[model samples]
Target chain A: MIRFEQVTKRYPGGREGLVDVSMQIGAGELVFVTGHSGAGKSTLLKLIALIERPTRGQVLVEGRNIGRLPRRAIPAHRRQIGMVFQDHKLLPERTVFENVALPLLIAGLRRRDIQRRVRAALDQVGLLDREQARPEMLSTGEQQRVGIARAVVGRPKLLIADEPTGNLDPALSLEIMLLFRRLNEVGVTMLIATHDIGLLDQLSGRRLMLDAGRLAADLGLH
Target chain B: MRIWLARHVQSALASLGRLWRQPLGTLLTVLVIGIALALPATLGVLVRNGEAVAGRWTSVRDFSVYLQPGLPVEQAGELAASLERRPLIAAVRLITADDALAELRTAGGFAGVIDALERNPLPHTLVVRPAADADDAAIAALADELRALPAVELVQLDSDWVARLDAMLAFARRAIWIAAALLVTAVIVIVGNTIRLDIQNQRAEIEVAKLLGATDAFVRRPFLYTGLWYGLAGGGVALLLLLAEQALLAGPAARLAALYGGSFEPLGLSRGGVAAVLGAALAAGLAGAWLAVARHLAAIQPRV
Candidate 1:
């Protein structure tokens, strides 16, 4: 569902984020982007999400060139892709239910639909009972699950995460990965960027490795 | 459409709830807006009252056309009849020389001294009342016309004080407009600053919302609503201030008018005036919030 053709990203002052990268992932694929710090993994996902445009070459999603998408169309384009972050990114003042309901609210869904979808998404994350609880009141794992629930509540076609398990312990990190695996099994495309090399065997997915902003390896893609 | 409306309602309530949690900050901001709005509104009310008083005082703008002393009473009566037929002259009454003499003898305390004169020295007079709708310029023009009439010695228009009052009231009205403009601008700035601070405080939330695919409109909804609420409350406070001023001044104003042998009622805001004040506040609030949002919202892209 995503393709990058010889894309290069160079930040201001000539620091290269990604150099001469070209890759493609088909529909419904759960892929992992791995590299050390300062690798181009996050930059690759950002190109797909249209957060930052490529400095050279084309980035396409679902056969559409998103590099040419107008600024006004960015939100709609983004709405089709769910995004999760390492920090959980939950509003501290809102309850778990409210946090999960945010994407639907931003989409301008009806109240009834919002409530129903929020509860269903929370149930998927096994946080149905904690819907009324605040984010700060939840455990670190639970908060991350809430973030996952929020990301998927809109039922986006592609889900991207930038080090989503970075803050969790090994066990909790595995749990989060399994949750992602469950979501992927249901036909949601997943692309996650992480530096945790040990968690790869627990979840079955293609791995694309980056080193010094270069595509060093593409394993399990024969 | 229904879903869109629901989202707006939700945003509005959420903003209101946030302000409610910080009662002191909200109250201080509202008070600042209220005082700004109240200054112009109060001045408007005072100007209206002044206009009301002037209306009562200038109701009758009459002129006296004094005929030559040697003019005959029949000619004066004819002149009064002719003057009454003019379009600008509402009514004309002929005061014959004999009637004037009789009136002076009965009303004036110098009756014996007047009878001591060999003959009556008073001239024939015509009291001409101008049309109620006649403006000052029109009345002056009609007065000049009367002065040019034959046998008329003098045309006296006792409306100079009324004209002065009219000019003063007009100046006051202009001043109110200027004051209202300046104060309205102040209110806009106040609301803009308040919304700016609010955006800064909610920076994290905004980033998250943007990351989650929120359109700029969605992120701006709550701040706009907050501005509207501030404007609404400020308008209410201004109305209350106007009412209080009316209450405090009504009795004294009436007493002062009574001393002048006239009744005065202190006028509060008319329905249109109230609507105007509220509308201005609401518009200013929305504009201020829009400006701040437009400038700052685009700068807060998700860094991740």
Candidate 2:
């Protein structure tokens, strides 16, 4: 579960990234965070991820105040949450299997357990055959899928994605959305930040829309 | 603990693999490090050799004492006998005016002219060899005592040569230290700059890894290992270079010793010295990597 209690973030240039925004995402719920460019959608997700601290209010994940978390405990806190980026930031020098196994490796999982889990995650992303292939050899969609596989390999409780389909075609984007839907159905809490209204229209999920650094609408359980 | 060690080992192996991916560049980098390490190593060997040579020269105690010109030969002989009675005086040879004149004639090859001179110009002299245990203080005390003798005109102790040699050795030692310090600084800067560039190149990957829950230790392990490899390779090369330099100098040193009718031994690195060199190289590499990581890692935080 994720909760933001009147969270406000201000950048150094006097720009309000997020202004007094408060929201709660329930366990195992799929939510869409829709906003135009520079509308603080990514900033909202970052607060949940603890990448940046909220200036005014507390940000909680799984009932723990992450803003007050000690510096040394940040990594442990992050291990409970998975994140995907628009660029599919996979190490180009590493193979798909290696990239996906990174999280498990950092978690200090046994080699056999890592192999099994990475295979299962790649299979979930329909990238099992491309496990040994390098990221450079994969298409943009495939790379994104690899990134998704990497994010979920550790079976994190919550998954946050920032523009996961920004570079994919319409067909690929729909497929990736369906993949997220499947992941959500399997009881993984999901929060996706995107500006694609068409994709939002196709998915039946709670929606939080932001405009001018403020939460403009919350279509609850739509 | 075992798991942590295992991760570090894996990280090191992964770093080596990355180095191997660009063999030429890695080799060049290692060679540069080796050259940097070799300069100080070679100087160290030279200083050791110089010290050895000076030590041998100083081991022989030679002193010259000049007696008054009108002093009786018996008085000079008595003075030499008194010097010989001291435990520190290993040997004392009395050279009267006639003996001194004869030695000068033999040395100068002017016997015919000396025989025609009106009178012997040299004064009575005493040459004293001190015991091996006699130190600078003992020598100075003995020289002062001899100078105070009524039959002695002056005691010109041949300690100036030893003093000059000691001064030279001290200067050389200082020079070696300064050179070593500068080279170490150079090594740190070179490796630090290289690692900084590497961090820049891998910035995106680091951000991604951090977002995926990789700790700073996990990210830093590979760079540390890379620095270790550079240090090890550099040390190995430096050792080889020093050995080669010794070999090249050995022949000439032996020939020079033969001309002096003495056995020459080229300086060899002691066990502790070798260990110090390796340790220093490793320390330099670690420090360089640490500095680079400390300076650059914070600038690479992910935006979202």
Candidate 3:
């Protein structure tokens, strides 16, 4: 669960990225944040992820105001949130299994538990057999799947995606969307920021729209 | 605690494996670090050895008392016996003028020239060996006492040579300190540059990890371990270099000792010295890595 109250983010050069945005998403809810490029969709996600602090007001996750969190504690706050990028961002030098296991490794999990969770995550993404394959050897769709697996491997409470299917073909994008839908069905809180109107048309969820650095519309969950 | 240490160790091993995958670059980096570390360590060894040699040579306190040329041999003998009775004087030997001339003749290999001389010119001498623990002030005091002797012409304190040797050793120590400081700077720069490159290489991975909830400490652990490995390897190489230098110098040192009619053993590093060298390398490595990571990690913002 996340809540933003009058959150504002300004760039170093006095460019307003987000302004007085008030929004909330309940636990186990699937929401869509749709906006044009530079419309502050990514900035909202960054605020929720604690990557950048809001310039004004507070961003709360799980009832804790993370705006006042110490820099050292930011990592622990982030551990509860899973994030995926449009680029997949899989490490090119490591195997798919290693990439997925990174979060667990950082958590200092036992090697056995790490292997178990990594294999299960890869299985969920339909890449169990390709666990040994490097990201460079994988297709674009497969690499994105690896990124998804890596994001969800630690069983984070919140899943945030930043235009995850932006680079995928229609079929591949649909397939990735189906994966998120399945994850959502299994009770994972999901927030996907995208400009894909067609994909939005196919999904039944809350739509929070942004225009000119402010929230312009909030279509309540269908 | 055990589990934590084990995990850290595993992570360190994983990094070492990654380094091994790029052996050429790793070897080049290690060699650079080694050379940087070895220069000062070798200089330290040299200074210690030189001090050891000086210590051995100065172990005995020697002085010479020149008796009046025409003083009677009995009076000179009596003076030597009286000086020997002093608590600081360990031993004293009286040499009459005739005996001094005879010794010069034998030492100079000029028996024919001495035989051709009209008269003996050497003065009676009293050679005094003081207690080994005598200090400079005490030796000077003894020299003053000998100068006041009725039969003595001049009192020559051999301790002046020891003082000069000590001053030279002090200068050498200061030089070593300067060299060590420069080499330490070189170590820091070399290691810092290496870690900076590593940070660049792993920038994307670091960003991804940050997003996934990896703390700076978690990300920094591997680089810290890598720096430690570099330090440990460099120290090992430096120790080997020092041993090789000592071996090479041993033969020459022995030859010089033979020339001086003394036995000399080339000095090697003591256990504490070795530990100090390793500790210094490790501290330099940790500081360098910390600097590079602190500077670079904060600048990496996860892309929204």
| Model 1 Cα lDDT, one tens digit per residue, B1-304 | 7777888889999999999999999999888888899899998898898888888768868888999999988898888888788888799988888899999989778799997999889899899998777787998998898789879999998878878998999999999999999999999999999999999999999998888889999999999999999899888888888888899998899899998888777889999999999999899888889888988989999888
- lDDT score for residue B153 of model 2: 82
Candidate 3, residues A1-222: lDDT per residue as tens digits? Answer: 899999999989998889999999999989999989899999888888888889998899999999999998988988888889999888888899999998998888888999999999999999999999999999999999999998899998899999999999988988999899899888899999999988878778899999978999999966
- First chain of model 3: TM-score? 0.98
lDDT of 1: 0.91
| Arranged by DockQ, best first | 3, 1, 2
Instruction: Please list the residue runs of candidate 3 whose C-alpha ends up more than 4 Å from where it truly belongs after superposition.
Output: A220-222, B97-108, B115-120, B131-134, B148-150
Best by TM-score: 3
* Local distance difference test, each candidate: 0.91, 0.87, 0.87
Interface RMSD of each: 0.9, 1.3, 1.2
lDDT of 3 at B253: 90
Ten consecutive residues with minimal summed lDDT in candidate 1 chain B?
A: B1-10
Record all residue pairs in model 1 with backbone atoms less than 3 Å apart, i.e. clashing. none
- Sorted on TM-score, highest at the top, how do the candidates line up? 3, 2, 1
